[model samples]
Structure formats: structure tokens, C-alpha cells
Target: EFYTQPVQSSVTQLGADIYTGDNCALNTGSGKREVVVPVKFQFEFATLPKVALNFDQIDCTDATNQTRIGVQPRNITTKGFDCVFYTWNENKVYSLRADYIPTAE
Candidate 1:
């Protein structure tokens, strides 16, 4: 069904919009109920810094589930880091990309 309302979705100023769901349509088959929509996000810390991260949210229809997907910095290492560390004078920082996946499970 076409949304009677314009679904409001936003990304971080630095986050990359990967794929917005062309998810469901008025012609959607009953078996084709769910599809995964993910936003790829990247953050570059010019100055090495620590952050607590959260992607945005999408409201759902009944009997649906959504989840955060892709590689989370917090998942790979003890500390979720964009990069290992920075050298004082190097001026090189960290860059990371993670996919936020929301799906119906």
C-alpha cells in the first residue's frame, strides 16, 4: 500500500544513505511482506575521539521487527573505534562505516 503519510526518515549529517526501501507496494504479494532497509554510515574523527552511537528508527506496521545491521565498531573490538589511534602530529584520524539494518524477522 502506498503510504498515506510521507514516512519521515533522516540520516546523520555525516552518514551515507545507502538504500531506502522501495520495500512494499500496493501490488505486494502476501508472501512478500518484508524487506531489509539499511543505511550505511561513516564517521571521520579529525581529532581522535570516543562516541556512543545510535542510528535512527523507522516506525512499523503490526507484526514486524527491525534491527541494526552491518559491522558495528563495538562488535569487532573491545572498544568500538573508527580507527586504532592517532599520532599527535600525524593529523590522521579514524574513518568507519557501518550498515544500519532494519528488517521484519
Candidate 2:
């Protein structure tokens, strides 16, 4: 599953922000499933800022045996970033609660 949310500036750090909320993806197969959730920012920066995934706060449910969840940032742009969620099981649902950290150019 893949989705996006509106950017909220009031809930962000000075240079960082949370562009998405509660984005979830489900793995219905027995192998690793990867889903890419797109996040939009308020403004386009001059350079690509550093992006990070808050994996510690992730909420996963209905996971199979030996299921593992992983997250990462990819295809980053000046305007937004992609939060990639990975799961290693069938019928596993991974919820994302990611944060973006902007770096000084």
C-alpha cells in the first residue's frame, strides 16, 4: 500500500518536518514486501536535505512468525522524500511515523 499526506509546518523542527502521517502498507506474500510512501514538503530547498526514518515509533500489527520490519529514505528531492517500509512476512501491516531532518546547505 502507498499513500501521501499534506505537509504540516507547525509540527516540525526548524529545518526538519513531518510530511506524512500514519502511512501504512500490508504484506500479503511470504517474502519481503516493500512499499514506498511519498511525502510532500512545504517548500523546495536549494539542496537535498538529510532525511531520516523514525523506526522506533513504527506500529506494526498482524505480523506473521519471524516477521521483521524495516524502514529507509529514498528518492529524496528538494520538495519531498519517500519513506520506504519493508516487511518480511505474510499478512503483516506496517504503519509509518517518519520524520524528515533538513541539513544546512
Candidate 3:
């Protein structure tokens, strides 16, 4: 027996651009102890994507005496965004490894 039938289906594609290998230093000064790490995407996205970050490794100057560290994303765009690494007191961040992933829906 031979039969012909058309199958109806829909496919949705999701994309996520990942950018890593950001090993920078954060030398915080007085007043506000924070560092703005600007990130530029390799390729521009069609729409504004959600930026997600993960601080894999962080090395501070002081090991024992160090304040709480905080991070935030600002000025997000289709091209890039900035990751702000801050601390309460004057604790200089020697180096840090941050990985960013931008996803579009």
C-alpha cells in the first residue's frame, strides 16, 4: 500500500552568543570601590539580548581581609554591555575571570 500525506510542523530556533576569556584587573579607588568592565560582542545581535554573567574566578589583593563583592549589568545593547564589579570597602581586585552569555528569544 502506498499513501501520501503532508506533515505540518513548526520549528523555533534559539540562539545564545557566549563571550569568555575576560581576565582583567579591578583596581578600585576611594569613594566608590567599583570597576566597570565593558564587554563587546563579536557579532551584533538582531535584537537586544539578555546578558548573563558568571564570575568563575576572582583573585583579590587581600585574602583574609576583604569586603563583600557585588556585580551588576548596565547599558545593555545589541552590541555589548558593561559589567560592574564593586565592593563595600577598599579591596582591590587583582584579577577576575568572567564569562558572559547573550541570548535572544
Model 1: per-residue Cα lDDT over 1-105, one tens digit each: 676976754322333332223332211233322223322234332332333334332322322332222223232222123311111221211222223322111
What is the per-residue lDDT of model 3 for residues 23-99, given as tens digits with 9 covering 90 to 100? Answer: 33445463356667687777787778787676766766655585566666789887888877766555666665566
lDDT of 2 by residue, 1-105 (tens): 989997644223232333224544453555677777777767777766776556546555653345477768788887877778777756455455455554435
Please report, in order, the local distance difference test score of every candidate based on alpha carbons.
Answer: 0.28, 0.60, 0.62
TM-score of each: 0.20, 0.61, 0.62
| Stretches > 4 Å off in candidate 3 | 1-31, 61-67
| Ranking, TM-score, top scorer first | 3, 2, 1
Reference-based TM-score, model 2: 0.61
* Candidate 2, poorest ten consecutive residues by summed lDDT: 11-20
**Residue 26 lDDT (model 1):** 14
Question: Model 1 shows how many backbone clashes?
Answer: 1
**TM accuracy, model 1:** 0.20
Measured over all alpha carbons after superposition, the RMSD of each candidate to the real structure, in angstroms, is 21.1, 12.9, 7.2
